[model samples]
Target chain A: MAENQGVLVYLEHREGKLLPIALEGLGAGRRLADTLGQRLSCVAIGSNIAQLASQAIAAGADRVYLMDSPELADYQPDIYLALMGQLVAEARPQVIIMGHTDTGREIAPRLAFRFGTVAVTDCVELNIDNTSGRLLATKPVYGGNALAVFSTDTDPQVVTVRTKAMAPAVPNASRQGEVITPAYKVEPSVVRARIVRRVLAESAGVKLEDAAVVVAGGRGIGGAEGFKQLEDLARLLKGAIGASRPPCDSGWISDTAQVGLTGKIIAPELYIAVAISGSSQHMSGCSGARTIVAINKDREANIFRHARFGVVGDWKKVLPAFTAKVKELLAS
Target chain B: MNIIVCVKQVIDPEAPPSSFRIDPATNRAEMRGANPVIDPYGEYAVEAALRLKDAGGAKVTVISLGSNLLREVVKKPLAMGADELILLEDAAYDGGDSYSTALALAAAIKKIGQYDLILCGREASDTNAGQVGAGVAEILSLPCVTLAKRLEAGAGNLVVERVTSAGYDVVEVGLPAVITISNEIGEPRYPTVKGIMAAKKKEPLVWKPTDLGLDASRLGSAGRKVKLLRLYQPVYEGRCEFVEGQTPEEAGANLAIKLREAKVI
Candidate 1:
C-alpha cells in the first residue's frame, strides 16, 4: 500500500547487548515478509553497534540498517523518532515491528501518528490479513483478562510486540546479509528532555530472565522475613526469586522482582509459587513456565489452578519441611 | 498554574477471576458481580496531580471519557482533592480505540483553553495499551514522558524519574509536558470523609462530542483508525495434580519427593 515495499523491525539494544525481544521482533517480521514475498530489514540505532549489525543479520534480517553515533548513545524519544521517521521515508517498508519496550512504547504511536496511521501495541500475536494485505495484531487487554485482534489499513503499519511473547529466530553465522549505514540527520535540538541521572537496581546472583527456576511469593508471605525462606528454596535449586504485586508494593521486595502482566514476563523451567493466590495478571507472566508448583494454605487459591503439582498448607509449616526434604534429596 | 489529569473508569482489575466474563457478541469484558472503579494506574496520576496541588496553589482538573460512567466512581478524583471534574460521557463515546479516545481528550483539553501540564496513567488497567497519553501529546504537539516513577515540578521545568527497561532515568523537561505515572509512585492517598463530602455536593461538568466541536466522524468509535476484529478470553487447562500426605509437614516432604521423582527439581 502507498508504494511500501518491505517489512522493517526496530532492533533495540542496551548495555551493548541486543535485547532478546528485538530479535523476537525480527522473527515475527521475517515470517510476515516471507509470506508477502518482501525482504525483511532491521534498523539498529545506537553507538558502538557494529557488532549488533552482524547479529541482526544472523537473526534473520535480509538487510541491516544502522544509525550509529556517539550522540545516539542514550535514547531520547524525539531523536529516535526522527531517525526512524527519516528511515521510513527512505526505505518505505510496509510494516514496522518493534518491541513493547520503553523506547518502542514512546516511538511506535508517535511514529504512526506522524505518518497519519495507528499503532497496535503490546501485541502477543501478528499476522497478515489474506484479502486486504493489512497487518493484524492480537494484543492482550484488561491485564490479560481478554485478548483483542486489531488491524489497520494504512501503509507502513506499526506494532510493538509484547516482550518475550515470541520465540527468537535461530541464528546462523553463515547466513548472508547486507549492512547499510543510513545518514543520521536528526538535529540535537529536537530533544527537549535531557537525562540528568541514571540508576539501576542492584540484582544479586542469578538474573530473573535467565533463571531456570523461579520461587515467587504473594500477599500471604506476610512480610519480608517470609521471602528469606523462599530465598533459601531458590538458592538450593540455583534459581531466582520473584513475588506478586503486594510484596513489591509492601516493600518486602524490590519492584523488579514483581511478576505480572505489567511487571516482568518470565518463562522458567520450573516456577514455584509459594503462598500466592495466582491472579490472572500474575498467571500471564509465568504461565509459560514448563512446570508450575504451588504451595498455599487455601485449597481454593487460584494458583493451584495453574500449578502442575500443588500442596494445600500454610507456607510457614510447609516451606521449612519442603526445603529440608529438597536439601536431603539434592545431597543424595 | 493549571494542570489536567486524564483518568478512566473500567471493570475492576482486581476483581476475582471467577467473576470475570467476556461478552462474545460485543467482544468486551463484563463482570457478573464486580463494580467498575477508577483505573488503578490512573489513580497514581491523580495522586501525582494532588501532590502538585498540595505543594502549590495550582488548580487540578480531572477529565474522563467513557459511556455509562458511575458518578461516585468518576468523582473519586474530586474526593481525593481535585478542583474540577469533566466527563465526556455518551453512547457515541462507546467502542472507541486508543486513537479516538485520545482525539476526544485532546479536543476537550483545547476547549478548556488553559493548561501548563498534563498527566495520565502509564496505561489503563482495562486496555493496558499505554498509548493514549503519548498519542495525546503527539496530537497536541507537546513533550511527553511515559512510565515516570516520581516527579518534581520546578519553576519553568519539571524533573521526573522515568522508568526504563534497565532501571530508571531522571529527565528534566520544560513545563506544559505530559507525564504518565507508574505504580512505583507509591500508594495513592484514600479520600477522607471531608473530601468525600465535598465531592458529593460538587456536580461535574459534562461534555459530549458536540460540546468539543468534533464531528461525528471524528468522535468515539467512528474516529478509530485501528479496528478491532475480535475480542476473546483465552482458555486454560487447569489439571493440577496434588501431592499430599496425612499431615502438612508430610505433604511438604511428599511434594519435594514427587518433584525429584518426576525430575522436575
Candidate 2:
C-alpha cells in the first residue's frame, strides 16, 4: 500500500464537458493541496472522456487519471464504485473531494464505507486544521437554520462540496500536467439498480444554478397562471424561473425549478422573489445572490428579512410595473 | 412483500427562524419553543411505502431511533397506515453521526430479518446529512438509489423514477434494495381520523442497545467517527434596505431604479 498523500478530486462530467461543480470542487481541492504542500490530482471516468483529462489539468491539477470505457458511459454505481475502490488503493490520496452532485451523492458514502469510514457531505467550507492536520467540513444543518462543523480522523478524508459554494478553478492552459490512463474494466453483469431510461427535464435557455438572475414564486402566487406572469419578468431579465416547494409540489412548475434545501442551491447575481415568504429552506438556496428583491403583500413576511429591496403589495399589481420599469431601464 | 421505512423525530424545521437557537456549550440546536415533529422527508418515505402497499399486498414496518421521542410524533407513520412500528429508544442512541446511526438501524434491521425493500427520506430536516440511507444500504450490503420521485413494483423488481439535476431516470432494481425518497414524491396523504384512532390503540415495540446486540462504542456518540466540533446559527450581520414608495407600483419601479444605480444588474 502507498502512503496516504496528495489531494484527489473525483471529476463529474455530462456529455463531453465537465460540470461547473466539478471545477468548483477542483478549485477547493487545490487550496487544500497547496496548503498541505501536496500535489493536486483528479480522475475522470466515462466513455471517450480521455479528453477531459486536459481540462482537469488546466483546472489546477498537477496530474490527471483517465478511465474511459463504453460500459462506464452511463453512471452505474456498482461499476464506478469498484473502479474507485481500486484507484484509492493505488493512489492513496490523503483527501478525496467530489461535487455534491447526483453521482457524488451515490458514490461518496459507499466508497467511504468500503474504506470503513464516513464522508462529511454537502460541505460549504473545508479547512485544514493547523493543529490536528485534519480536514474540517462545515455544512448547513436544520434546513439551513444552523451550521455545523465536523472533522474525521480516518485516512483519505472524503468530502462532497456544495455547488457554487467555492470559487471555480480558473483554467490555465499553460499549466503543466501529465495524464495517466489507470487500469480500467467494466463488468456490467455485476451491476444492479441500472438506469433503463431517462426523461430529461424540459428547461430552456439558462439553467437555474447558473442563471445570472432568477425570478421565483411561492404559494402566494396562487397557481400556475401566476407563474406565467413571473415568467414575463424572467424573460425580460433574460433569467431562469424558479419556485418554492409549495408551488412546485402543487404542480405550478417543474420540481427542477424548486430552490430550497432539498432542491437546487443557486448563487445568482440577482434573485427576484415574488410573494415568497422565504422559509429558511428556500432562503438557503438563494441567500448567496448578490441582491434580493421581494414583492409580497404582507409587510412582515419572512421574505423581507432576507431581501435588500422590497415592494409591499400583491405580486399581481407589483410585478407588471417592476417588469415594465426593468425593461425600460435595460433598453435605455 | 415486506417493506421497512426509517423515520426520524426532529425539531420542527417549519418553526419561525427567530425561534431557531443553538446551545454552543453542548453543540446542539434548541428550538426555543417549538415542538418536534416527524421529519417531512421521512413522511414521504412512509408515503412511498404506503403507496406500494396500496398497489399490492405488503406489510409496511416503521422504525425510529432516538431519545425522548414524542409518542405523537413517532406514531405519525402508524397513523399513515403502516402495519407495525419499532422504536430503538435509549440515551445510548443519541448523538450518533450517520455512521453510528446506520450501525444501530442496520443491526435492528438484521433482527427483523424479513424485508423486501427499505425506504428512507433523502435526508433528515435537522442534521441534513443525507447519508443515513446510503450508510444503512452499504452496512447491509444492499443496492440503493437516492432521490426517487416515483416508484412502482414490476415482476420481482422495482421501477423507480430517480430525480436528477437534468431530469429523471427510470431505474430497475431487484428485490431487497434501498431507496431514498425526495420531495417530488408529492405531499404524503393525510392520516384519516379512523387511522389516527387505530394508531392510538397500537403500542409500538421498543428496543434498547442490548436488544440489538450492540454496546456503547458502536451505538451512539462513542461510536461517532466524525466529531461535531461546533454548531451555531449563521448571523445575517448585514441590514436589509427596504425601498418604499407612495404607491406599491411606484415602489416596484423604484426597486428597479435602485438596482441600476447599484450596478448590480
Candidate 3:
C-alpha cells in the first residue's frame, strides 16, 4: 500500500470542543510539514465533531480527516483504537503527532503497538533533522535529571508533544482545506472498557500541568498542617500547590498533586520549592520552569543548584513573610 | 475463582537519587543494591487480592515479569498466602517499555485462563508509564478500573472508589474485571515468619515467551512503540542571590526588597 506522505496531527477534543493542545499540535505539524515540503493533515475522531474540522484548517492543516461515530463520544479505548488504527492504516502519514494529555497518553501507546512503530511520549520539543529529514524528539528522562534526544530510522514517526511546547498558530480566516470523512467499522469486541463517568477536577482555575506558577512543599513542611499555609500561599499567588513524592507516598497529599516523574509534569513561569531538597525525580517534572525559588535551612541542598533565587533559612519564617509581601504587592 | 496480580521489583523509595540510572547501551536501569522491594502500588494490589481470597476463598496466583531476582520479591507475597507464583523471564524482555510489557503479561494471562479478576499497580515507580494495566485490560478484552484507591467485591460486581484529580468516584463493575490499585489504598502487609519459612520451599513456575504462545517480536524492544534515544542531565543556568541580614526581621526585609526589585511580589 502506498502510504500517505504528509504529516498528520491528531486533534483532541472533549464534549465536541477542541482543546488548546490540538491547535498547538497543528502548529507543530504544519511547521514540520512545511519543512518536509508536504501538506499538513489532521485527524479528528468523535461523534458530531465535524465542526472541529474548520478549526484545524484555520490553524494550518491543509487536509482534515474526520472519523465521526457515537462510540467515540466517550473515549472508549476499543472504539478509539479501532477508529484511529483504521485511519492510520488508510492515511499512512509519514509522521503522526498528538498532544501529551490524558487521551494521548492512553491511545498513543496502543496505536503504536498496532502499527509497529515508535511513539515518544511527553516530548518537550520536536524538529526535523535537516540532514535526514527525520523527526527529532527531545524529552526529559530519569525524572527530569536529564534531557534525551530521539530520532527514528523508520517512516511515520509518532510522538506526543507536551502542552505549550509549541506556540498556537495565528488564526487564518481565509485558510481552507479538504475535509475527508472516513468510513469506519466499530467492532463489537472493541468497546471493552467504558468510562462510566468523568470526575472533573475541583480547582477550576488551573491544573498543575497548565499553571503559570507552582508552589511545592516537602518533608520540611513539618506535617499535614503545613499544607494549609501552602494552600493559602498558592491561592494568593493564583498558582497550584504541588508536593514531593515523600508527602504523596506518606499519604499527606493526593498523588495527583505529586510533582515528579511518577506524578504530573509541570513547566511553569516560576516554581517555588519550600523545604524540598530537589531530588531528580521531583526535578524532572519542573525542569521547564523559567525561574525557581528555593527556601530551605540546609545550605547544601541540591535544590539550590536549580533555583534562580535562594533563601537559606526556615520556611516557617520565610513563608509567612513571603506570603504577606505577595499579598501586599497584589493589593498595591 | 482464579486471580493474577502482576508485581515488579523496584528500588526502595527511600533510596538516594544518585542510585537510579540506566546503562545507555543496554537501555536498562542499573540497580545499585539488593535493597529492591516490591513496588509499593503492586503490593497494594497483592494485598487487595489476598483480602479477596480471605473473604471469598478464591485461589490467588502472583505473576511477575522480571529476572530470577524477582524470586526474592515473590517470596514476600507468597508468604502473604498466595497459592501459586509464575515468573516470566527472558533476555528478549529486557529494555521493553509499558506496551510490550503489557503484551507479554497479557499473553501469560491468556495461557492461565479462567481468571475471575486481575490486579495491577496503577503505575510503576521506574518507568511511571501507568499504561500497562490499561493496555493489558485492552488486549484481554476485560473491563478496567484505573487508580482504584479502595475496592470491594460484591455479590455479582466489584465496588470501587476510584481516585482522580477532583476527588474519589464510586464505581461498580461486573466480575472478570481488571483493577489497578493506587497508593491511596491501604499499606501492604508484611509477610509473617511462618509464611516466610514456607515460601522458601515453594518454587515459582518460570515461563518464556514461547511457553506462553507470544510472538517473540511482540515481547521485547521490537514490540515497543516508544524508544529512548539519548539522555543527559538538565542544565541549570540560573544563579541564586543569597539574602543576608543581622536578624530574622532584617533578613525578611532584605528578601522583600529583592522580591520587589524583581516585581515578583
Candidate 4:
C-alpha cells in the first residue's frame, strides 16, 4: 500500500444528523486501515455538517475532511459527486469505503467512475490479503442463490459495505482528530435537478429496510385483508410489515413493503414470516435477519428449511395469539 | 436530440426458484438458457426514454453491456421504438462492478456524443446496486434525477416526479441529464409485431474498449478497485416449537402461550 494512500470513508448524514451506518463504515474502514498499516480518514459533505465531523473521528477516523455547501444540503447527485471526485483526486486514497445506504449507493458508483475504478457494492464481507496486499470483497449473487468473491490488483478500491454486516464502533470521545475544511466550488448552473419537496409515507417508521423486527405475510395469507392481522402483530411488536413478492405482485401490499431480492434487503433482529413459502428471491433479502420464525399451514413449505422456528398452522389462527402474547409481554 | 437507454437482460424473476446458479470457476451466473426477460426495472427505463424521445422528437438509442444475449435485449427497446442500438461487447467487460461498467459506458457515451439525455433503471434485479446510472452521471459530469416515477417535457427542460420516503417531489432539469426511472413509473409497453420486425433488421453498433478510446487497464477487472472475497449462505440456527391447536381460538391461545414463554410479546 502507498504511504499517502489510506482508507477514506464517506460519512453519510441527512438533515444535519449523522446516520448510524456512517459510523459503521468508519469502523469497517478503520479495520481495513489497520490491516493495511495505513491511516484512516473520513469525509463529510453537506450544509451545516460541521457538528457531525467529530462523530466520524470518534468512530475511528484519524482525520476528517469537511465540505459544507448549500447545494449539498439535499442529495443532488451532480454536486455531491463533483465534491467527492475533487476530494478523492486530492487525497488519492488507496481505498474509499462508504455505507450501502441511499446516499452512499448514489455517490459511490459515480465517484468510482469519475476516478476510473470499479466499486463493489452491498458488500457483506471484507478483508485484506496480507501477502497480495489487496482488499477482498464479497457479495450475494444470482438473487442470493450464490456468493461471488472478487479482487483487483489496482489502486483506489471503492466499496460500499452493507448495513449490519459489521458491528458499529465504540466512540472514543477523548480522541480529537485533525479536521480539514475543504473549499467547495459548486455552480448553481450545474445543479439542474432540485428536490422541491420530499414526501414520507405515513407508516414510514416500519420501513422494511431499516426495521429491527419484520412480520412478513405471503400468498398463503389468502388476500389483501390478511395483512391486517400481520400488520396488527407488527404494530404490537413495534416492527415493520413485510411481504413476499407474491403478495406485492398481487397488489396485496405495496412494493416498498416487499422483502426479497427484487425489493428491500433487511436484517431485522426478529423476522416473523407468516404463510411465506420462502422462495430464494425472498430469502435473499431476509437472510441477514438474526432470528427467523415461520408460520404456515403447510408443514412442507420451503421456508421451514431456513427458518429457525416454525409452526405448522394457519397464520390467521396463529397471529392473533402471537400479538396478544407480545402485547402482554410488553405490558409487563 | 439523441437519447440512449441502457438495457440489461436478466433471469426471468418469475421463473421457479430452483433454476438459479453460479458458475464457480468463471465467477459468473450460470443462467445461460433459462427464460430471459428484460430486467423489470430496465423496462421502466426504456419506456421512459421512449416517451421522452417521442415527445421531443429525439433519436432514441438503446445500449447494453453484455454478451450476444444483448442482441435480443436491445431489440426489445428498439421494437418499442428506439432508433438505434449500441452494444458494448467483450470478454474483458465481464465481472465488472458498477463503477467499471459505468466507466466503459461513459466512454461509449462520449464516443456517441450529441445525446441530450440518458435513462437507466434505478437498479438491476441481480446486483441491485442502483449505482451505475449515478456512476455514469458522475463520469459524464451530468446532472441526474433518481427514482423518477413520472416525467413530462418542459420548455428546454424535463419535469419529473421524484419518489422519496415522504411522498413525491416535482423537479425540473434541463436537457443533457441522466434520469433513473422507478418501477412504479408505468408498465413497459409491449412491442408491436411491426416494431419487432423492424428491430430484427437493425444491427447494433458493437464496440469494445479499444473502439471507445478506453485503455484496457482502465476498463475491466484490472481497473476495479473493490473485489469480492467470499460469499456463503447464512446459517439459520433457531429452535422452533410448534403450537398445536384444533381451532383458531385454541391456536391463538397456544401461540400466545409460546410468545409469553419467549417474553417477546
Candidate 5:
C-alpha cells in the first residue's frame, strides 16, 4: 500500500487578498485529513504571503508551507506549476485539494499528470473509501443532469472542489500550527510563461457569487439592451446581474457575470432568471439558490420546474412591472 | 505553420431537464432523443485557431476522438475553415475517460509530427472535465496555457489574455504550446454556404488505435486510472409555485408580497 500521507490544500490569492475559495479548500482538506487521521497542510505560494500562511493555520490547517519569492507574484503558470510540483514532491500529501477556479483547474490536472495520478475537477462532494482509503469524489457529468461518484486507485488523489460546496475555515485566532518555509530554487530562465499585463473587467453593484439576489439574463433577453433592464432590476434589489452562456457568448454580458458549469457556480439567496429557458448546463450552477424565480416568455421553459416562483410571460413586460413592485415593497 | 486543435463531440448540453433519463441498469444519464453537437468550447478553440490562421498563413487540422457517429459533428471545424479533420474512431475507444482520451490525442499529435501549436476547449460540455488539454500537454512534455480568452500568434511565441479571478492576464509564451480556449473568445462564426460546400468536399480521414500504434492495454477504458462507482442525478426538492393573476403587474406585485411574507425580501 502507498504510504498514507497528509492532506494538502493549495491556497489561492489575488491582489494581496486571500481568495474565499482558499479557505474553502482548507475546510475541505481539514475534513479529509481528520477522517483519515492525517495532518492537514496548507501551501501558500505567492509574493509576501506570510500573513496568509499564519491565517491558514488559524483557519484549521495543521501545518502551513510557505514559499515566498518575488517571482511568485502575478501567477506565471510555469513558475507556479514548477514550485507546486516541487512542493508536492517534498511534502508528499496523499490527498491534494484545490478550488475549481481558473488557477486550480489549470494546475491540479497538470500536476496530477506529472505524478501519474488522476485528477477530478469541480467536485461537489468528496469522501474516503473505508477499504482502500481512496478519495471518492462526486462530480457532475452530462451537464449536471447526473453525478458520478469516482475514486482513484493511484496514490495522492488530486481533486478540485467547486465553490460554495464546502464551508470555509473560520479563524480561531488562538489556533497554532507548524509553519514550514521550504527552501526552493526556481530559476527565472526555466519559467516560460510571463504575464505582461492584467486588467479587471468592470462590474457594478454586488459581486455575483456574494450577492443575496441575482438577476441573470439569458439569450431570450435578446441583446445588451435586455441586460440593461436586468441591471436596473439588480440595482433595485441590491444584487448583481448575471447571465447564462448564450448572453455571455453573444457578448451581451461580460464573462465574469456568467453563471453555469463552465462559468462561476453561484448560490445566491434568491436567483431571478430572466428570459432564460433553463438548460441543465445553466441550472447546474444556480441549483443551490434558496429560491429561484424564473421569468420567461416560453411557458414550457425548464427553469419553471426548479424555480420557487414561475412567471409565464414576456420578461420584457414582466421585468418592469416586477421591478416597480420590488421598488414599492422596498420603500414600504 | 501547422496547428492542431483537439475537438470532441458531446450530447447537447442545452437539452431540457425532462429529456434526461436515468438508465437504472447502466447507472448513467441518457437522453430520450438527442442530437450531438461539437462541444461549444471546442468551437471557440476552432475560432481561436482560425483567427490565428487569418492573421498569418497556417494549416489548421482538427483532431477529434469519438465514435464514427461523430463524422458529421467532426466536420464542424472544417466548415469553420480548418484545413483538415482527423477522427480517431474505433470500438476500443468507446467509453474512454479523459485520461484515455488525452493519451489517444497525444499519440495522434505525435503522429502528425510537425505542429506549431495545439488548441482545445477549456472543458468538454458532457464530462465538464477541463483536464484533457493539460493532460495531453503533460504526455507531450510541452508548456500549456489554459483558458485563453485572447491569443495572438506572434513570431516564435504567442501573447494571450488569460482569465483569472480578478480579471485577465496578458501572458507571453513560446511557440509549440497548448492553449485551451475559453468562452471569452467570443461567438464562433457560423459557416457560410460556400464554407459548408468546401467542408463537404474535404472528407474527414478516420483512424483507429492500431494506426497510432497504441496497444489495447494502454488505450480506452483499460487505461483509465479512476473508477466510477455510480452515476445518478441529484434530487432537487423544491418545485416552482406558479403565480397566476389577471395582469402581469398584479402577478409581479403578488410575487413581491409573497417574498415579503416569506421574509426573503
Candidate 6:
C-alpha cells in the first residue's frame, strides 16, 4: 500500500468539464510534490471522467486515478466517501489535497477522521517546513481577522485549499501519465440520505465568483431599488453585482451575492464597494481583491479603510452619476 | 422528541477589523472591547430547531463549551426558544480546537441522553474551522450532514435540504443524526420581550469536564490533535487616495479615469 505514496489531489468536475479549483489543486499538489521529491497524482470520481483523467495529466499530475461508476454521475456523499476511503487505503499517499468548496469542506474532515487524522480546511497557503519536513498550512481564523499556521504530526496530511488562492496549472498537451481505474463498490442500502430533488438558483448574468470587477451594494443602498443602480453600474462595468450581508438579509439581493466571511469569498481584480460599511466579516471575503474602490456617504465608514480609492458622498447622488460616467467612458 | 443544539460564543463577527489584533507570542487573538455573541450560524441552527419545535412538541437543550464568560452569549439561544442551556465552563476547556471541542461536546451530549437529534452551526465564526460537527458525529457514531439550508421531521427520519455547489440537494437521514446548519436556513428570529423575560428564569446549568465523565486533561490544548504554530494578521498595505470632485458625477468620472490610468479596468 505504501508503494503508491505521493501527493494525491482530488479533482472535481461537473458536466464532463474539470472545475477551476481542480486545476488549482493540481498546481498546488505539483508544487508540494516537487518540494517533497515525490510524484504528483490526482484522483477523480464520477461515471464518465476518463477524459478528465487525461486533462489532469496535462494539468500537472504525474499520475491520475479514475473511479468511474454510474452511481457517481451526481455527488452523493456516501458513495463518494466510500470510493475515496477505498482509494486512500490502497494508495497510501503521503499528502491529500482538495479544493475548499462545499463538497471538500464537508468530506475532507470526515475522511481524515476515518483514518484517525484531521484535515486543515480553507488553507490559503501550504508549504513544507525545511526543518521539520512537515506540511505547514496557513489559513484564516477569527473570521479572516488573523492567519494561523498549522502542522500535524500525523502522516498523510489532508488539506483543502481555498478558492482563488493558488494559480491554476497550465495545460501541457504533450504531457503523459498513467490512468488507473480502481475497482470499488458502493452499496445503495447503506446510504440513508437520498437526493429527492435538486433546485438550482437561477443565475442572471456573470456569476459574482467569476467576475473580475464587482460592484457591491450594502444596507446604505436603502432597499432593493438601490440595487438597481448597482446592477446598472455592474452592467456598465461589464462586471457582476455583489452584496454585503445586510443587503442580502434585507432581501434586496439573494444570499449568493453576499461577499463576507459567512458568504462567498471572492478575489476579483477590482472591487467597487458602495455604501457598505466594512465589518471584519464582510471584508474577509474581499480582502484578496487586488484593488478596491469604496463609495460611501459616511466619511468614517470602515470600507474606506480597506479601499485603494475612496469617494465620500451620498450614494443616491453618487451611484447614478457613477453609472453615467462608466457608461460614457465605455462608450467613448 | 428532544434535540440538542451546540452553540459557541465567539467574538462578535460584526466587530470592526481594526478592533482585532493577534499576539504572536501566544498565537491567539487579542480582543479589544469587542463583545462576544453566540455564533451567527449557531443562531440559525437554534432557529431551525425552534421551527421544528413549533411544528411539533420537542424540548431543545443548548450546550456550549467555553469560558464562564460564555454564559452571557449562550443565554441567547434560550431567549430564542431553547428549553435549557448547559455550559461546560472550566479552564480545562479553554483554547480547545475543533477536535477537542467536539470531543467535549460529544461527551456532554452523551450525558444528556435524551436527544433524538443534534444540530450545530456550519462553523464557528471565530475559528472558521468546520470540523466540529463531523467530529462530534464521528465520536457519537451517528450519521451527519453539513451545510443544511432546511430541515423537516419525517416518520423515523429527517428530511434535509443541503446546499451544494450548483444547487440544493434534498436528503433524507435517519433519526439520531447530526446536522450542521448553514446561514441559508434564514435569519434567526429576534427574542421577544416575553421570551427575554422567560430566559431570565432559565438559568444555565454549569458543568465541568469531569461532570460529563471526560478527562479534564483531554479537554483543551492538551487534547488538541492539531498544533497551531503561529498567528498573524495579513498586512492591508493598501493606500487609497481620496477622489476629489465638486459633484458626485465629477468624483465618479475622476475615479473612472484613475482606474483606467492604473490599467485596473
RMSD of each: 1.5, 1.5, 3.6, 3.9, 1.8, 1.9
Each candidate structure's TM-score, on Cα atoms with residue i matched to residue i, is 0.97, 0.97, 0.86, 0.84, 0.96, 0.96
Which parts of model 2 are misplaced by more than 4 Å? A1-3
Could you give the DockQ of candidate 2? Answer: 0.76
Across B36-104, the per-residue lDDT of candidate 3 in tens digits comes to 777877888998888888888889888888664557776778998888888888877766777788888
**What's the lDDT for all of these models?**
0.89, 0.89, 0.77, 0.77, 0.85, 0.85
Query: Which candidate number would show the highest DockQ if scored against the true structure?
Result: 1
Estimate the overall C-alpha local distance difference test score of candidate 5. 0.85
Candidate 4 residue spans exceeding 4 A from truth: A1-4, A14-17, A69-72, A204-212, A219-224, A244-265, A279-281, A296-302, A312-332, B31-33, B50-59, B70-74, B78-100, B103-114, B165-169, B190-256
Tens digits of per-residue lDDT for model 4 on A1-332? Answer: 33448999988887776687887888888899999888899998888888887777778889999988665778676677778888887888988888876567667776776666667777777788779878888876656666666677656788888777777777998887899987667766656787666666566556677778899999898888998888887887788999887786577877668676546778898898999988777887797887788888877666777776667876776777767766776787
The candidate 2 chain A region of ten consecutive residues with least summed lDDT is: A183-192
DockQ (C-alpha) of model 4? 0.44
B104-129, model 2: which lDDT tens digit per residue? Answer: 99999999999999999999999888
Residue B151 lDDT in candidate 1: 82
Indicate the residue-level lDDT of A249 in model 6: 73
- Once superposed on the true structure, which residue ranges of model 1 sit more than 4 Å away at CA? A14-17
Of the true interface contacts, the fraction found in model 6 is 0.66
The backbone clash count of each candidate, in order, is: 0, 0, 6, 14, 0, 0
In model 4 chain B, which range of ten residues has the least summed lDDT?
B230-239
Q: Kindly report which residue pairs in candidate 3 clash with one another.
A: A94-A156, A118-B225, A119-B225, A143-A284, A144-A284, A146-B232
Scored by lDDT, model 6 comes in at: 0.85
Reproduced native contacts, each prediction = 0.76, 0.78, 0.36, 0.58, 0.78, 0.66
Q: Please write out the lDDT profile of model 2 over residues A1-332, one tens digit for every residue.
A: 55699999999888889889889988999999998999999998889987788788889999999888776787777788889988998899999998888888888988888787889888999999999888889999998888889998888799899888988999998888998888766767758889889888989868998899999999999999999998988988889999999998899899999998778989898999998988889998899988888888888777788888878887787788788898999999
Candidate 5 local lDDT, A222-254, one digit each (tens): 999889888888898899989998898788878
Which is superior by DockQ, 1 or 5?
1
Q: Is candidate 2 or candidate 4 better by TM-score?
A: 2
Higher-TM-score candidate among 2 and 6?
A: 2
- iRMSD for each candidate structure, in the order shown: 1.3, 1.4, 3.4, 3.6, 1.4, 1.7
